[model samples]
Target: MNGLSRLPRLYVDPTLVPTAQKGAPCLLTPEQARYLGTVLRKKVGEQVRVFHAGMGEWLASIAEIRKDRGGLVLERPLRAPQPCPPLPLAFALLKRDATDLVLRMGTELGVSEFLPLVTERTNTHRINPERLHAIAVEAAEQCERLDIPTIAQVQTLPALLGNWPHQTSLFAAIERLDKRENTLHLPTRQVQEGDGLLIGPEGGLSDNECQTLLKRPFVVPVSLGSLVLRADTAVVAGLALLGNGLRSAPVSSQ
Candidate 1:
């Protein structure tokens, strides 16, 4: 018996498997089936594991591969469904290229959800959820993450803070005197089992936005570093600190 190891590295969409259910047989969509069965040369009885969004994980075996959908004869459950711990990014929108970069990096850095905001200085809040989801899927596939991150609908900074109920909120800031002196730190696993991080636009959050966050109960102002960074740069840099298994932090806290 070959123990189930992940082989659902979906390099293409059509080959992506449907979210496998626990202890219940499921079929891979046409595109995914063709890729696995035809393109990748996988066949009946092959063992593979597939993941759904925080539905724990699924164990399945290839039962049939056809021109359309592929069938999987699911076996006994391998692991209990694990929900993603709270992780959110309230980020301001930027230019097309910059936003895309932030979205991609943020996904790999393990942001459970994204809230795109249009601040005073932001260019647009034109978020492409589908494209972002695709980016996240690719990132998750490459990183061997058990699930794909969710891209929340775009919302304003004030709006997001208004309805805030859960999560430890973090404001990415390296500007205040004390903060510049080095009070900035990233989220620890234990500290962030249920927390969220905020990244401003390229121009940074406006004074009003900053003040609003400061007043919020859950928000904690944080700093990235000495130099001001571009929107995309801050996103990648900030998320790198907030999420784990990425490059090391630029500096240690005092």
Candidate 2:
């Protein structure tokens, strides 16, 4: 059997304060306890794979199981803490189901961070951070990801653009293209640590908004083929291309 397939995976809250040594007792949060004891029916002595966003995955054994609380004893380290490739995705906020899909699939696709943007064409400005966090956690657990993607608070597109970092590369998926030659080519060079991909809202960015984005030196307009893709679909396709490129390129030591 594959090594990761051997044990069930669980994402523990780093705020719970787990020590990084064998025989240390790691207390579970109420929710985590309920999940292990009730949902999974985990019993004392059963082994589990546990991980935190700050700390990498570890092998742990169930030490205590109670109605409202549970504990795990850290046994050994599974994977060390390594930085996720800097593939931050800035996407215009979508409707409930569509937003949920992006959170789940994006986490599985290994996006390091997620930025929810309120664009000119966006329908809703509000996003449920708690719900999105839960979705990312569940996706990470199922996909065997070492860490969950950080979900930023909802911000306006203009604000996001204003504060955009200089070192990070940005690729925007544009819907309008007069010629095939106008499509921005995927980076043939090595991807740096903090490259980002941006996708507009479902109805697409307003003319003024598109013009504003195009004026930015860091923003490169890319096309996701000739057809117009839904907001969620564009996220998956864009991240898929970026992820492949990042994985293929050799990491720079500088």
Candidate 3:
């Protein structure tokens, strides 16, 4: 365990990772095998940290490394299991690269769930769930997050608002509102545990969409200042603004 802190970390599916007890052998995915063997040149007996949402993180020693498969022997626990907070981020679906950036950065920024909204001005409604989940897992692995963020299926703006929970307020960033008609400021208040942030598409939500959002009691209209930002950029900026309100403290690893 002396050098375990320096080992590469991998996010493993709980169902596939087996038990968490010491000396238990855990199986690795083919991609992980390639990554450890070919990519990182990891060999037998080298230690690594494997973690997941429900199982927390464990130190393990590489049992074997082959071209298409690998296994690790569990050594001990590093961090206790903790679920991600319900700080959901609802953003209008953008192009491929931008959407990927949103997923990666949003995960790094402590977003627990991603709500992809299809607004009136959205260019596309399709999302590759598998690809996005992979990006999130990779980002979580790099960011040292204990849990991965969940990505919701693509839905319309109205649909998202309809299914939204009543207890949590949804902070929506809608720019250039008539000062007379709009009174809500950006991040009106600090974000609570279950509160969320919503960013519109590149061109911003349509007039009708803005009206629809403003009408909702749970939706808090927000302004991101004078400068308009790209959809991806807005996601980062909006999360940064609202992060201060989060009540959960960061989990320290031993």
What TM-score, over all chains together, does every model reach?
A: 0.74, 0.91, 0.92
- Best by the lDDT measure: 3
RMSD of each: 6.3, 2.5, 3.6
Which prediction has the highest TM-score against the true structure? Answer: 3
lDDT of prediction 3: 0.87
lDDT of 3 by residue, 1-70 (tens): 4665578999988877768889988999999999999999999998899998877998889998999999
lDDT of 1 by residue, 66-168 (tens): 8777877656555565645567787888887777777678766777888888788888868778887777777776665566667878887778878776455
* Residue 244 displacement (Å), model 3: 0.9
Error at 92, model 1, angstroms? 1.1
> What's the residue-level lDDT of 12 in candidate 2?
83
The residue-by-residue lDDT of candidate 2 on 1-254, one tens digit each, is 26757677888887664567778778887887888889889899998888876678889898998878988999888888765777899999999999999999999988889999988889999988888999998999998778889999889988998899977778888777445342354343345668898999998887777777777778867768888899999999999888877778786678
Ranking by TM-score: 3, 2, 1
